[model samples]
Target: MFIIIPQTPQNYALRIKQHAERTANLDIRSGVNYRGLAGFLNRPFAEDHRDATVDVTNPAEPPLVCVKSLVEGGRQTARSYHAVSDCATFEQDPPSLVNKAAHLVWLQGYPAPEWINAIGAQYRVDPEFFRRHLIFLQSKDNHDFAAMPSSAQRMLTLRLTTICHTQFALRQTAIEAARNEATNAVRQHQQRLRTGDSVVRKYSVFDNTIFTIDQELAIYVERKKQHNGWIAIVCSDLGKDLTQGPGGLSSPWLGEEPASPPACEPVIMHVPKLALKHPHQHRFVNVTSNGSPLMYQNASLLADTIDLQSGGDDIYLDVREALHDVFTLIAAAESQFLTMVQGLVDREIQLQSSGKQTEWTLSNLRYFKSSIDDHIVNLENTLDFLRHPDVPKWAPHTRSPRALSREGTPAGQAQHSRYRSPQGEAFAEYSRLSSLGDDYTRLLQRATKLSNRCVENTTILMNMAMLEESKKAIVQADGLTRLTLLAFFFLPLSLTTSFFGMNFRELGTGSMHMWVFFVVAVPFLLFSTLLCFWGAVLPNFRGRMQWAWKMFTSGAR
Candidate 1:
């Protein structure tokens, strides 16, 4: 039997009708004629054509059909629908298979949510199906979440929340597996180093490219933008010309042939944008990674990557990879922080423009502040993790030999002593080599702390810039308002002055009395002008002028 689905006021019935016509080739309205069931399905109903349709089928049961029809000329209509079979048949069809394989589910008026949920639930039958379906759901959910209405956003959020709950458990398992692998690799590396065998190994943890110790040079370049005036002066001094060319030849046999112009090669000095404050040097430690000695520098800014031999062996670990992971975390935190800041800025702009005297409680600002605090804490924790002793014991040590010489009387005695106790010197050397691991561990901790601080400081600087920009915008708005007010107050005075100063010769013939009258009027005019200027204009103008001056000077400095 045919059933009519009423249109909800919020629903886009017209849009649905248009979609059906375009996609399903089902004309909801055919000219002006009103068609019943056949025309509604095949063509369109002229009376109430705006509605949705869906075709449903079950492999285990007979096929069914349902359609939604709008109430005639009414925005609020009873949600009526037509069904070929009983409601039980439509409900019991296990919408999953139809949703998963159907080419045109929309044509039958099956809501997308019902189908998606059905398909997702059905994935439990097969393990691979579950994984693929979850991935699909995640992709679809993310896309839809971005475009969904606020109400729909909640649904999208629920979907993602479920996915996250499921995925996180799996992620934990994966992480545990990875940790085991890393631990095993580290142990193998330590064995090789203990045997004092030379080995070259590639590290997964550290970067290959070593940054040069030119951080001072980098800082100089970076700071130049902030010190524009100082930079200008330095540039001018360096750019001075030091050249004298021969003057044009004089007459009188061309001054016995003008002296030949001195030909000299122009001295070209490459002046760096800024000079390095100090020289930095580093040596490569022969802790091999991938068939090469791993090198690291002490300078935090200068060191782009470092290799640490793992498990006390020649297996070098890439510090860059670890740093990359840290950087990724930082970036995610930064994005969330930025989003919160943007939301605050938007609200602030709206509030200020609306001229509300009440202070705005910017929820986003608080959210952002909280987020940043958490991020900083996380960074500190991560830094602690990096400084853990286990992470750095991967690189092997390079051994060096030193010569011991004894003097004169000692030379005679040294021959006897050397033969008597070569064992003592060897013992001392062994002790020093054994302590090298402890020393390296301490050095790694120091380096890791410095790097973490650099990242933290950079983030702080970015946030400060945002804060300054917001303040600047507010100040600009206030200045504009003050300027506008000042202009308004002066407008009447300007009009008065203009009116009296006009010719207006037709008012009176030339007379001495007119001149006397004018003389008398001038003082009154001056008095009135002074009264208005001092009483109303001067204080406000002075205040605004002072504010502007201060803003400009402060900004310039």
Candidate 2:
């Protein structure tokens, strides 16, 4: 149902320019002509698209695109898989769904500019709505995905899945590795200090280690903002086929008259897959299920749920259920994030409790502080999204009251009738979303508290590091003072010896007695010793001297 196809970069600016020129007269507003439009389109995502001279030598790898189809025949609903190797073909002459059908067509990938217009035309969407959709895609704003924008006539579903476990695991590994390296570096530095090596060399090692870890964390946070984003569209007229009453679509395949394909296309969805740029980048793997990528598996599961629950008969119920499923994925992502933050909190606690906080450099504290701050900002954004009024109200019922009244009526007095009102289902879904929101709120609170704890721990680590530095400085000053005093005490003795060793005439003729040299050296050595003792007690003398200086200055004044 899902596969990857190579998509090299094309002249996107030229495409937009041509399209804008063709549609120039449609909008007569000042500065709303082809040039402006082209400029606007060029600004988003790939700004290099604006430059005609830019080379496309390093084209990106292929990205995964999913195309799924569910069609109705006489007595059964048949499912099929499709792959669009040529996006142009998929856009201009897309595969059709049965007109008299209760089927679902899901296409997931990024659409070319022309493809966006084609989707608008196929869905009978308002040109204005599709233009906004086009701009939405062009903007590539992740926050909009979180906001879940929609229009009454079109069901625009945009979702940003959590960071894939592969990527998350890689980042976690990086975090742990950095922590271990810093820990080891700290130990080595302490050993060097004990062995009397130059402190400056060990300082460099610590600085480099911390800087590397900080850079890694910075990258992690930056990439965190850009998780796998997805957009899905459900046509407003999807329920029209169901309006034709029970037995599904009247298809040529059923009567066996050469079984021609249906005239209408299936509902297409788009998912722009990112190319892997590094060894540790996202890779397709089993996420919460086996044998398929996470989003694809999720899509399949969603299709299965629709097939089972509403039997693909009620579009409203289908959308409701789909949105609920999406929220479930979001909730799971949030829980995972919470767990990650908790791990960080625990690590900080471990570092502190194990007495390693004293060894932590300011750089180490900086990484944690940056990590905590980034997560808090991200969590606050997520929490705001969860608490947004629009979240619970998503996929609201758009049917007329009369239709609702008709659907609400019970199907006879049968005890086990499968007659569930759309209203009841909507209420149930709303309640589910609200409950999920509450859970997210609790998770956010926990994450916030954990982040705050990390902040506190960072502060403690900073203080401890400062204290350690102060202690080291004090010890160094004490050692220097001892060395200075020792040197000074022996200074006079050295001077006296040097003076007596000089080749003087009196000394050469043995006119000078050896006791004269001893007498002179002894008094000088004693005087130096007394001076060392006086300097040792110099602080006491300084306080008295300061008092005396104040009195003297006061008298002078």
Candidate 3:
């Protein structure tokens, strides 16, 4: 039954205290304290009323908490699809009416802490498992958490928790939208200033770019706050060897008998909001429209022919089959993220080469570096989860017939002992999960490569800026050289004129002729002019002079 708090003050206090006490009772030896569990329980659920005008399929829309299950339609009849708003539906349905063979429950979005607590209690699962599992999934870092005992190793149960790295264009789209909006605002401000408006006087290219990039950075951070949690499946053991019975019970989720036991009845799969099928992924929904709602789109129909042929002993085959679409969506999202980053990088490269790099380009490059770094963290985390030690084995194991025959004889036993049995998919999904790991590693490498490129581009931009500054300094020095040359040329002419016009006895008696002044000043002027020309052209003159002398000697010869 669901925990419903009454509207009375005393009742609210009682409920809060009860929830807190329940969370506190959870084993803290794992160092997980059910953090924020009480907070989610205390807060009222935000209801989203349906409206025809609302776009349910929009990636930006809030996700709903959907609980999907299977119920019987008739005696010896195929199970019918049933969906409800709460976990209580599982308990409310009669055991006879529900499918006891496999209890399949799918939750689309993150439920309240109370709901998770209730689910854990109902399934008799370790509350610490959910806590630790969530801690790994939601944290952005790739560090290790406090080690917890595996289900099989501790409680003789089956459990699997995996983090899938899914992507969406919400960040890219929102950041770009913010940039355009900022640019338009800046342009308008500039237009106002150009019209001599006093209100828009203090603005520069630097200001414009900083504003735009700051807006983008804010959007980037906002996007980072959104996270898609992990996928968890918990099954209970019947406390007996499955092989002992003639008609062995198998979970409807997996393949044949070799498959591991499925989680407890009414298997609970917490599919994060981030893993919901995109609008384009739905078969009957309008892809052109916004999107469909969070209506258990991730649930598997268990329609695999392999399962049917094997009597559904291997539930993981269906589990893997169900996740195929999720994986595909994740791939698409990753592609989008990479494409966005690459486009920015290409744009920067073009700008840097063409001498058109601006403050915006530089700041944007810094932001790109940060985004790539964040992406690398996510990739590493996903890789770490895939490589977890507690995961179920992938391949099946069967003894060789030769080894079996040898088991009866000493020599045969020796040979059988040496024979390696083929590994099987007992309880885990190895090959598919490993394949995912490889893909994530590849993505991580790509992200790292882009980060390096961003740094390189940033360095080159700084060097080019410095080069432009040096060119300006050289131009100023050239102007100073020209002024010095003019001063040198006028110096001798001024000196000669002054000497002749001085109040000396010879000059008073006209002993100093005007011709003398001209004679002395003209040669001095010519010499000064030559000196100035040498200062300006000596390097070029030396090379030209060598070439001319060579030409004249060749002609004489």
Candidate 4:
């Protein structure tokens, strides 16, 4: 029985406070948490009910609703519940709160920050009880009860099942988004590599190849074009709710990190998990499925795929169709990259007259190598998603349709099996996706190999060019040294002949004394010798002298 309460938090808190006070006075907690009409624990849906007035200003807190039912083995009374007059309905004895009876208190939202304070203001409860129940709550949601056997004892199992499905849906969504982004990133890199070749063209030996489009503008372009990610909608089951999961999410619950993790941090020393954060952030880009984010994601962005595949469509089909679209985009982007690489490689082959690698070509090759690596990552992600363990775990296994004909079998069991009943048809798609992933991997591998080979060729060509240039430099320096030596050899004779050719008739030979010859010849001879010693001789002698000095010093030491 649904007992709707006012949305205001205070209304719920009031009843909880009253229950605590009464339970304390009586010195015994109730078997069922909520009271019965004038007699025992009330079964509300089986009796009186009312609709709640909702107020949503406070995001941190939502109205709490209590679900009270008979405990296992508790005797059923003929009296019906009065939702408002539970105390009046019970004449002599009131219901016990936490004894032999089964008690389920579904906190509609997360444990409100004020819950403890509100409950504690009047009465105190065990801190451990709150801590344990909250985690049990973490694993619960509305879907579990949406399809279930109504035994509250099986709440934990139902909750865990919800989380498992949640985890997979999240994983599938995140993988698709990430891989698609990776493939597109590679495609974008290729475009820059090809169009940015104009940078290489801007250079000749004169232009110095020092600056290119890639070096100056590519970084800015990438930063500008990069899509900084954001979340648009929360994907969760918000239509209805239950007690089995972390509180039944009446409101959409995506990724809300508590101000703190489970309050008992010192006791349980493990890292807090952020797995939910991923899929919650990675909204489906262009399609819809069980894993798709809320329709609000495409509210102003685009039309949602959920509209086309809404009522009664198979979830697996929706998922595959979404994935197929993504893979197509991935394939197309990769093909463009391959085309660019092929063109570059063909050009490289045709230009047989290879020598030194220009700075432009070398830099471009380095960037292209990064694209090859990106493609490899994209391919691996594709495989990882296709073969995810959850896919098989969630599939209906090899049971024949006849095996599922039992009338009482739940719909979830029938739909979830991979090979069982009608679900084999759905699981068959997993094999196809895996095969597709393999095909794409081969394509990526081929591209990477081609890129690797081209890079190796460029490296070899650059090394050879450097070696040849070094040899030319050495030979030119040697020729310069030889010419200097020959000039010195004829230097004194040339000076003497020039002196004879001079018109020195005005100055008599008498004025030119024997001392003059000594001065002129000796100075010229000394200058010539000094020039030859410092320029040619010292060049060859320095290395030998250094070696000999080092040897002598070592021997002395």
Q: Estimate TM-scores for all models.
A: 0.18, 0.48, 0.44, 0.33
Each prediction's RMSD to truth: 33.3, 18.6, 18.3, 22.5
How well does model 1 score by local distance difference test? Answer: 0.27
Give the clash count for each candidate: 34, 8, 23, 28
Q: Which tens-of-lDDT digit does each residue in 1-557 have in candidate 3?
A: 98754333234323433543553257443222443333433333325522212122333221222222222221121222122233344345512211212222322222334344444444434443444433322223324343443432222111111111112123444445544454454344333221001111111111111210110000000000111111223221111121211223221111133333222111132335736755333222212133321111122211110111121222222233223333433443454566556876898799878878766677778877876686676566555544442332211232224324546888655544443223422222333444565676787788889899999998988887799899999999999988888788879878876777764455576654556666888899888888878856888889899999999999999
The lDDT ranking, best first, is 3, 2, 4, 1
Per-residue C-alpha lDDT of model 1 across residues 292-389, encoded as one tens digit per residue: 21121111111112111111111112122212222332233333333333444445445544744122123223333443353444344333332332
Off by over 4 Å in 3: 1-36, 44-87, 91-105, 109-114, 124-313, 316-324, 356-358, 389-431, 480-557
Model 1 residue runs over 4 Å out of place are 1-440, 452-490, 497-503, 506-557
- By TM-score, the best candidate is 2
Candidate 4: segments with Cα more than 4 A from true spot: 1-322, 352-359, 387-431, 486-557
Order of the predicted models by TM-score, top scorer first: 2, 3, 4, 1
State the displacement of the C-alpha of residue 328, model 2, in Å, after optimal TM-score superposition: 0.7
Provide the lDDT at 125 for model 4: 34
Q: Is candidate 2 or candidate 4 better by lDDT?
A: 2
Please provide the root mean square deviation of candidate 2 (C-alpha atoms, Å): 18.6
Clashing pairs in 2: 96-265, 97-264, 107-269, 108-269, 108-270, 108-271, 109-270, 109-271
Tens-digit lDDT track of model 4 for 177-261: 4334543432332233210011110110101111111101000000001111100111111111111123212211221222211
Better of 1 and 2 by lDDT: 2
Once all C-alphas are superposed, what RMSD does model 3 give against the true structure? 18.3
